[model samples]
Target: MNNTKDFAKSSWIALVLIVLLNSCGSAVKSTPPPLRSQAEVVSVGQDKVEDSVEKKLENVKIGDAQAYYYYQLAVLSLASGNIEEAVDSFYNAIKLDDKSPFLHTELGKALARKGDLSKAKEACEKALGLDPSYLPARTLLAAVYSGLNEKEEAIKEYEKIIELNPREVQPYILLASLYKERKEYDKALGVLNRWIGRHQNSEVGFYHMGQIYLEMKDYEQAARSFEKAIEENGDFIQGYSALGALYENQKQYQKAAETYERALKVLGDDPRVLDRLLRIYTQLKDYNKALAYAEKLKDMSPEDEEIDVDIGVIYYESKQYGEAEKLFRGYLDEHPENIEVRAYLAATLEENQKYDEALKEWEKVLEQDPKSFDTRIRIGMLLSEQGKHDQAIKMFEKTLELFPDRIRSYILLGASYNQAKRYEEGLQVLQKGLAVNEKDPALLATLNFHIGVSLERLGRFEEALTTFKKVVELDDKHSNAHNYIGYMLAEKGIRLDEALVEIQKALELEPDNGAYIDSLGWVYYQKGMIDEAIRELERAVSLIDDDPVIHEHLGDAYTKKGLFQKAVSAYEKSMKLKPENEEQVQKKLEEARVKLKSQITTHTTGR
Candidate 1:
């Protein structure tokens, strides 16, 4: 075993932090035979004992001295943890001196170690009958009763020990532990409180009380108890740990941070304490503080992957995306098999708008774990935003295959199809979504709106209008339903007044919506309120300068008002911007040319 004194000298703080205190009022030392009590001297006369035994055996050894030899054998074997050999020796001893309580108790312990509980109990009872004051026999008997799940008998034996020796802390500690384990919390607290009163100076009592209070969720009391424990024994690292944890559980981050910071002061440079401080800083959203502590811990324990991840998290949470990505990448370079960190790095890249780089990272994650539904879903969402709807759809479908119960994937795929203008396909996807959750107003509205758009594309205005009405019914404030249905009606020059109402309602819900404003202007134009149409269209055009449809409406309104020069200007602007609509642009350009020619011809004839 490593030298405990050397380990303690190297890091005294680590010694205190690692010394797990038992309820029995003793600290576990960093040595072999872990938490056992100080060794009791079973015998101290090895030379004298050997000489006396040899002298006693001289005459019998030449012929037979089985019982005497077995007694000696049992003592040697028991010391070596050789339970079988000790049992054999104890059997021989018992055959010679059947009333020997010590031999019977030794046999009982060996039987218990060998998992012969019934036989062990019999041996303990026999030892107790021989000598009722044998503490080891009684203790072992209690263990036997416990193993048999005879709780009353176990408690009686433990109580008897307590009555016999009230000053000895083991029985009280053991009894309190049993009560705590059974979740008879009040009873456990009572026993522990009595123990503290008896051993008032012992930090063990206060520490155990704090643990019980913590389990009871009385954080305030637990913290106070821990503080008292620390006050009594400043070297009690566990007191500081529990106090810090109490503050953290209350979400009093500043207090938690302060408590953890204090723990560091008490237990200096402990890696576990430093790691906890890092988390406390994170909870406070003070990532810079977290990073500062994390760097220290990383230097202390360079190979700790969890600390590396913590540093990466601090950077990510602070919005230092580039630095976070670099850390994660470096970590993955060494821990290439760490799928979680790889995935996080990919997410960070995506957040930075580095789509291509992000995709590479994501692909690596998928290579390692092809069945990751979450990663597949993220890939789909990213591709959809980049306008690669086909690839996005495939990714979403794959995610659904992995997690068929994921409702959001279906919703996303439907929206992606709609963005691609495959309205029929979009409607089909949304219909399936509705089947999954029919009463979901948002999903119903989506399905109806897409169905309406599909019908509108096919020039079935009546069917489209009915579908749009259903969408509005499902979600009275569905913005797209109002705009699409209203715009279609305005374009057809039917229900122009009703179309204006729907468009106005849409604009009310989304006042900054240029599309709804354009719809309102178009309705006014269809109703032949040319001046009103000009004002609204000009506002819509200003708000949505890149919308070809708004520019087209503005140009047409100008043409209708006999502002031929302005009309030509608006049409030219629209034509330049809407280069994809070659047929419409050509028609608008011809109309502007005709208007310009008519104005010139009239001016010349008048002159």
Candidate 2:
């Protein structure tokens, strides 16, 4: 229902009345003997007193000028928003003129403002009792009912108000809101539509309708409504923002970008608009644009850790790893507790080959939050890559403690155990994983492959061959399985022809994979095709220069071909690459040297 301007004005008066009443309770026992004038009762404005007496009260008969002054003062005070003073002046005015129900309604609103709901209700009822058609009293009654949360009664009062003044807009708005609060969405829309038909030019009406559409997930209608609102009022900031959000939700990134740009024009220096643009640009893969908007947002809120993180991500995604690292460090300095930043920084460092540094960062994250199973797994994987197999196993085991179902951790930990030559532990771990998740293709394949690796390392070639066959049968497309089993078979001298087929299939799947290429080369070497083996091994070494195992394979191929000096050189290079194999390489080197010296001595003696 419509709250008249006077009702709002009267509420302020009610606050003053409460303050004055509380202040006076200990000071004055009764209403002070009637003031000589309303001006004497309170600080009345000069123009107001003069205007009230000269204009509104001149037609009414009062017992004395003080009565006239108080009567006019009450109406003047109510009009002026001095509601408490209005109530007091109204009481005095009634003392002079008691027949006016309109004045009682004013008094009721003041009472309502003071939270005297009971008295306010009585006063409003009395005003209606005195004048059955008193619209102001009825409207005040609705407000009182609303304050008491008597929603049905409030609605009834508002309906009465609408009936009395069919052309008014406020009662329609309130009724619509009431229906919306009750989740009667269709009814709410109906009310709003009817209201919009009458108030078509109201941007507020359009905005409200747009919000309703948004709630219903009617993006098209919502966008249309928001656009209409914007067109009606070009400076409408919320309309533009709402429209932009609608487009974003629809994945119409370009439209969303344009809408946000318009919103930025209307709301200069708004952080929210900048953030929306940043997100949109990221989705569009327009990293440069995303960074620009991110910088703008940072300029406004320099300490916003989320925006800084976004800027870092843009850099990282665009392959500007160095810039990304700097920003990530800057963000970490400010928001050291942010796990996401720590994780991203770790990932970025890992991508840049700073594996040890990344491991340390992930460790810190785990230290802060031991429940971070994902980070623990990443650290374990990094450690394994760096050949810290035992440490990597520990990290993976800790991760398994937190998340027993993460089968990837089992695979990684098992692989690390094999790398450390703890074949028994590796088999047990893969077996445990397989027992739990039999249908998991990746896990099953990995289990079979690792079992084969461990059995072969233990010199159980027959058992290893059986396990490798199981791995290929379970997943023919498992390229590594093909490579390893084929390489193992060729090495064991039991099925050289069959091994060639498996390794060739593996090479077909991943031709450029250096390890797979090396496997093919080693299989050829086992088959005694010295020239072909050398060609394949040389290609593998060229593809991956850092792998000591590949260099060792090259040395073995050369030795098999009777190239003593070349074999020694290849063995020394392998040892230099990985001193962890120094003892084996030195023995091989000494044997090659002795063989070369004996051949030289025999040639000299024969000459």
Candidate 2 least-lDDT 10 residues:
23-32
Candidate 2 wrong stretches, greater than 4 Å: 1-184, 249-252, 300-310, 330-340, 405-409, 434-607
lDDT of 1: 0.74
Residue-level lDDT tens digits of model 1 in 1-607: 5566433222321111121111223432211121322221112212233334444345322113566678778656645657689788879888887877767876776666555778888998999998998777787777567666666787788788777666656666567666776788888778767767766455666777787888888877888888887887777777777778788778877887787777778778888778788888888888888899999988888888778788888888888898888889888889899998998899899989999999888999989989887788788888988888899888877776666555565666667777777777766766666556456777767766776776776577898899999999999989889888789889889988888889988998999888888888899899999999999999998898987777888888988998878878787887778656768767886888897898899999984
Clash pairs for candidate 1? none
What is the lDDT of every predicted structure here? 0.74, 0.75
The deviation in Å at residue 339 for candidate 1 is 1.5
Q: Count clashes in each candidate, considering only residues at least 3 apart in sequence or on different chains.
A: 0, 3
Least well predicted 10-residue stretch by lDDT in candidate 1: 13-22
**For residues 342-459, could you state the per-residue lDDT of candidate 2 as single tens digits?**
8899899999999888888988888888887677778888988898888888888877666677777667777889999898988788767765645777678777788788888888
TM-score of candidate 1 to 2 decimals: 0.67
